[model samples]
Target: MPDVKFKHVVSCSSEDPKNPAANLVAQEAFRKWKGVAGQPSVSVILQLEKSTKVRALDIGNEFSAFIEVLVGKSTDTEDAYH
Candidate 1:
């Protein structure tokens, strides 16, 4: 597996500002889950230092009725995500 570097959080649909989406990239396994509730759906946007093909993703203890993953090229504009 290639070294994966998490750059930053571009956006999130709903999150407890206190907890923050950035917690998802915590280096330690002791980090708590980034919680978002009272919403029908939630989304998170993350930036990577380099473009890479995501073969797999590991989500911690969180519940979602549905999950969707969309990959875009590094050169893609903001509109490309929507």
Candidate 2:
């Protein structure tokens, strides 16, 4: 498996500062879920220390009604997701 880690929140459409983006990377099932009041479409960007080829992802849908995954290389300057 790729050694993935949360780098930073590049941008968020909406967020509750108290419940931050870091919560998405918690090890334990902590009460840390990033929230947006009215916005249904939100975006979060995560970075990897080194290059990686992601095959699959496991995201808990406890809070989000729907979710989408996008992958890109570190060198890309724009949000050109694959």
Candidate 1 clash total?
0
On the 0 to 100 scale, the lDDT of residue 27 in model 2 is 59
The parts of candidate 1 lying over 4 Å away from their true place are 30-35
Best by lDDT: 1
Best by TM-score: 1
Clashes of each: 0, 0
lDDT of 2 by residue, 1-82 (tens): 7446665556666557987777666655663556576767767776766676667776666456778888887788788898
Q: Point out where model 2 deviates above 4 Å.
A: 25-31, 63-65
Model 1 residue 1 lDDT score: 95
lDDT of 1 by residue, 1-82 (tens): 9546778777877777767787766665554445567778777777887877777787664666677777665588764853
Task: Report clash pairs, candidate 1.
Answer: none
